[model samples]
Target: MEKFPRERIRNFCIIAHVDHGKTTLSDRLLQMTGTVAENKMKEQILDSMDLERERGITIKAHPVTMIYYFPEEKEHYQLNLIDTPGHVDFSYEVSRSLSACEGALLVIDATQGIQAQTVSNAFLAEKHRLVLIPVINKIDLPTANLTLVKKQLEDSLAIPADEAIATSAKEGIGIDQIFKAIIQKIPPPPSFPDQILRALIFDSVYDPYKGVILYVRMFSGKVKKGDKILLLSSNKTYEVKEVGVFCPKMVPEEALYEGNSGYIIANIKNTAEIKIGDTLTWETGGTTTALPGFQEISPMVFSGIYPLNSSEFEKLKNAIQKLQINDPAITISPESSVALGSGFRCGFLGLLHMEIVQQRLSREYGVDIITTYPSVIYKVSLRSGKTIEVDNPAKLPDPSYIDHIAEPYVKSYLIVPSENIGEVMQLISEKRGSCESTESLGHDKVIMHCYFPLNEILVDFNDKLKSITHGYGSMDYTPDEYRISDLVKLDILVNGEPIEALSCIVHSSKAESRGRSIIHKLKERIPRHLFKIALQAAVGGKILAREDIGAIGKNVTAKCYGGDITRKRKLLEKQKEGKKRMKTFGKVDIPQDAFLEILKTDTKQS
Candidate 1:
């Protein structure tokens, strides 16, 4: 195989809002380039994970190299296409993907003019100084508004409406036009073969047989088999076992050069040794400076995950480690719950990310686990003039020990139909959000900016926003400074014994109502036993609400029909004494489903 000139390599990625036809456009591009055979073509070829396909969302960013034969130029160009996730949770992934490219394909749905994320990701591409090629997708739909969408692209993004390519990715219409535009509009990557080897590790995955495989883009020099390489971040050296490019799949190559994207295998046994955004260079080379890496990603939502059965704890641990190899954004720490036993307090970028991780553990690793309700980190200021960050409700200090508690906040950006402005504002207001600003995008679209507690919007804000806006709303948020708030820890007790796993941090204003709802739900789920079970919700040892599951009735009077009333009363008294003793010494066995149900319940509804 011959190495293509660096000037012929066009490295770019597709970025857009969720359900904006990014993956579909990628599939059409692959087909036009003959990279994938027609018979083997499938929907969302870049989305390899089953969860991504089933959920109709891209959870991970994927890269593939294609050979496009430009008929006009009568030459073949090497095109590298990176598909990125559209959700805000994976915005970090989008930023890293942009670093490896010189251009980006900004796809937008024709029916949905300009979404919050489309604007957010467009600014991200501009931040990376990548060339942006606007593509209006789904043009074949009945409700497609090409004129309005084109105007939106021009007004919001400052991209010329004429430059935007109209396409129907589903029907393969205007695909050839898109291909032509790519050749003319997108610039090629710069070559730096004279410099020492410096490859940026954008992504990686662990394989049981091959160990850790790194997906990287070479910005300088070359890497080949048998070459000794050093990970600059870790200062670790290893011999390169193989180097290859992904033609939709890993294909071994003799070497990878500048302006190329490919994979590198160095016989890495432990995933911890390889870090995303780390620089890879030749061990003996003179590359003194490393590439500017990505910013550290902090988790926005946290929950405790435990194995359903205590014996499967090791399996759960191993499964999480394996999953972490592919997804480094998750943060996990060991935690022990008095009621749920051993578990890990896991942190995720958002609720979707949390759900995906849980589903993957169950589907891929067959690990049945229970997860607690999610919470955001809080800063608690103590009377001693010291402040501590608390991520778990069980770790919250007593009310008397703290001066004030601060919770994370976000600057939320929302775009919705103008007619639904009232509904959207009401929804945000209900979540403790305050209007920061509002702007009119056009005749039909309105942009609203609000400041909201991060915990308030982490769970169902998006769902409610869409519900009120008739699925025409889009939102993006960035973390703001933490502010002092009236936060308290709500604890649940079963049979008068506190269950650490069922505790949650909530606003003091809603503690009473939330507590009542929790106890009520527990009463319906808990089973009746020989002894009555008491479920109570308390805050700082003051019980706010309680519920009781009546004990199973046993007839003591049936055998004493001919006896005196006093004899019956004496038998009842003896039974009451036994019940009292059982309530004091007997342990209540809380079912796993009960814990799961509590976590799954929407706190707002509760």
Candidate 2:
């Protein structure tokens, strides 16, 4: 296939919610543009990750360059395709991908219309100054309503409704129109200076056999094989081993220059030497200024990740370090967990990001992890006029030790069909969420943006939301600010010792019920050991709930049966002979399962 001319080169990303036909549209575009043979095209062609394919959700941002031939002018245009993730947790990855594009194909499900994620994604694109081309996808469905979807986009986003393209990517209907719209509506990337070799590193991945592959967008200068470049973010230099442009199937070696797009690979000993948002310049005298947005991402979601087997701590650390080299968003630090043993305190952007990290650890690294309850970092002030940050529930200061505690909250946007608005409101209200405003998206759709306590929705919120909406409503939320609320730290004592696994925080109102449930569940799951176990939930020295393990008489009395009858009798006599081994209903050792059961209890009862 012949490469298109430079003037027609367009770099754009496809943004949409999960199952909004973003990938299907991409396949159609590639097919119509003659970039791939019709027979070779498959579902989610751009979601090259095995996990992404299995889950049918785009996680990593995938980039592909295609050639679209225009019949009207006998022209072949170069199209750099960027496929971005749809989950809110991966929004950081989406933001990085948006920076590399000049425009975006905003996809909307015709029947479903604008979703919560769709609005947030479009806002991100607009923030980055990317031209938005609204496309109503999945037009082949019987329930697809293009007119309604168009009006929603126009009224809500202030875009032209008539300009929207109705496309059925599965059947390849109106795909050509979308492609034509891309060339007409999405302008070519603005030309940059060719004097310097400055490229923005959007993302990087490690290929064991191929070393590290860096995804970059060059703003100026040219890159070729054997060129020595310096990574501005890391301050480490590398000798470029190979330069190649993406061809969908294989990365063919090609010379990419200014106003063009592609990725480059340089063999280096340490993959950590490269980072996202870094600038690549010639080692000797290529460029002096570094690219912007080089700050490392701070993790908002925190959790204790430990190996199920204590001996795997070293292996777990190495696996996490290696994963971080590719995933810069994941931050790791040494953590000593009382219940889970030695582990690492890892940070992530959100829930989905956390899930992806844990999944990758188990699947990619072949490590068994014992993950603790996910928690948000809390800022606490002490009476001594000092402040401390706490992530572990066990580290929570005693009531006397803490002056005040602040928790993080978020401004959440929820998009639901008009019929489900009532249900949506009720669910949010229960979470201490207050409605900020409500606006209609055309007729049958309403967008509700509200302020909600982050902790309220941190657990099982996604599942509960889907169930309430009948899988129709979608949500997107961003951390807003820390707010002071009436919060109490609840502790669970096992045999008079507080185990980290049973520590939790509950609103003062629900403390009794939540604490009771946690104690009951822990008692049921924890196996009986030699000693009786005492499960107690307390708040500020006040016991709220209690449960106990049954004791054995014969097993306890065996110690007195043998051993110099007189000495054994003398030893037992001090405790009234067999009375020391008498059957006590509340005596049994707490097993590992006891701690794990605490996580499964209903700790959010109100």
Candidate 3:
């Protein structure tokens, strides 16, 4: 248990786009530094979630401390490297992780060059004032064009091309260069150990035995096992149970000093008691001044998450609350649906984030849930000039009572190969988005500056963009100003009963097409019943799309094949009468999957 001086420590993280080999680069660092033993090593060692590993995308931020011997100086330095997610949905995770570091490694694929998140992450690192070292990864690929990529580094990212380091993370090449760059380029944390305690809680996780394990960055001062610490956000004090550092795993440390990024357990029982961006100080003599916390992220996507079993509502609630502790970026509130029973209206950064939360609930908490159609928070102005925000289409006021609806839009950065720009532009028009400007980068890739309604791209925009570009396209977006649109409420009816859960807000121009797709998808999922079930999508009492689920029919004439025709007619009329009565009283047995099917967005058209 040794404490290192702030001068010999460097805190850094890797930032890049999806599939840019960030995790692989991180793996190389751990291997080169010998932080992880050869026998214990695995691919994407930092990505702990099964989903992350399966999808080959980092879902959560991971931190580890590595001891590197600088042969030139003949001294060991402690490098705290936090691996972050590359997807745009996890941008918030990247931002919070950056707040704890003094530098970052901006990894770009040499084969693919600079993509969407490379720019977004670089912007984030600059905002945190972190020194960025650009690393061009995957140089061993046959398609690797280091020359073109270097030029892109200067043109698109404005970074000097010579500053970029070329390496193939998969082949374990140039590992020492990254370490040398980190030590020679990145500066030590600016901290005052003699001053009163000031640490920022950037992230945390819940443990059944330890309660809450807080991941922290010590800005100044020091903390020990027996020290009493106060969290400024909660205004509560607790005795530190233990202190440790992430050596890929929890390695107990005697004391955490200034510039150290580590963990603290204070026996805090509830996650609500400890805020992610809260500041920590000594319980008695600490200064009241709090470190600048992270910006509160507003969810760009909203959906309802309901458990399959109604009585398990509490179980789902508890599960979501626990998850919220780990990921505070998600917005949660109690919401009930007439068709789906009780559930929570959850808000997420994007569709991927929402999907992750739903999967976690099912896998981690073992809760089978249904997710409603995703929507964006819209600004609705009533005829009386009173404006309100609506996240759910069912909550939207009637068309007669509303004056105009403003939908959220994003300034999107879409980069694609030159040949696919035309198709990409056409796709943009299909989604009700416009290309504000186009800038050609290097020789082949073009960056399209587009403004798209946030809701228009929620479902499968990224997927479609990738398909059209043959997987060379990438997009990153930030919320832009809300604009008034010709919008309407599209509601679905099941056997003459309005299903609130299947309703969504849509642009009036696309309502008919969207409705037709939804009902068709629903028809595929809805099971045959004894009585005919009608599925309709309507707005203002006018049906825009209709699909029928035929009843499970029995051949009334089959049994009377050899009998008289009059007898067959009597049997057929009786059967028809029974069907009419059943249709009046019988309910459609819609599967949980059908709800998702009805809300399944047709991304191609959207």
Model 1 misplaced stretches (Cα beyond 4 Å): 191-194, 530-532, 551-557, 561-566
Task: Tell me the whole-model lDDT of each prediction, alpha carbons only.
Answer: 0.89, 0.79, 0.89
Q: Estimate the Cα RMSD of every predicted model relative to the unseen true structure.
A: 1.9, 3.8, 2.9
Clashes per candidate (backbone, < 3 Å): 0, 4, 0
- Candidate 2 residues 381-450, lDDT tens each? 8899898887777778888988888888888888887898888888888788899999998777789989
Sort by TM-score, top down from the best: 1, 3, 2
Scored by TM-score, the top model is: 1
lDDT of 3 by residue, 1-606 (tens): 477888999999999999999999999899988999999999989989899999999988888999999999999999999899999888888988999999999999988888888988898899899999999999899999999999998997889999999999999888889999999999999966467889989888888899999999989998999999999977899999999899899998898988888999999987878777789999999978878748767898999999888889999999999899778788899998888999999999998999999889999999988888888999999999899999998899988999999999898899999999879988999898999898899888898989999988888888899899988899998788999999999888888788898788898998898888878888888889988889999998899989988889899788665867889889999999999999888878878777755555432454
Give the candidate order by descending lDDT: 3, 1, 2
Pairs with steric clashes in candidate 3:
none
Judging by TM-score, tell me the better candidate of 1 and 2.
1
lDDT of 1 by residue, 218-273 (tens): 99888999999999889999999999998798999999988899999999998788
Please give the range of 10 consecutive residues that has the lowest summed lDDT in model 1: 285-294
The lDDT of model 1 is: 0.89
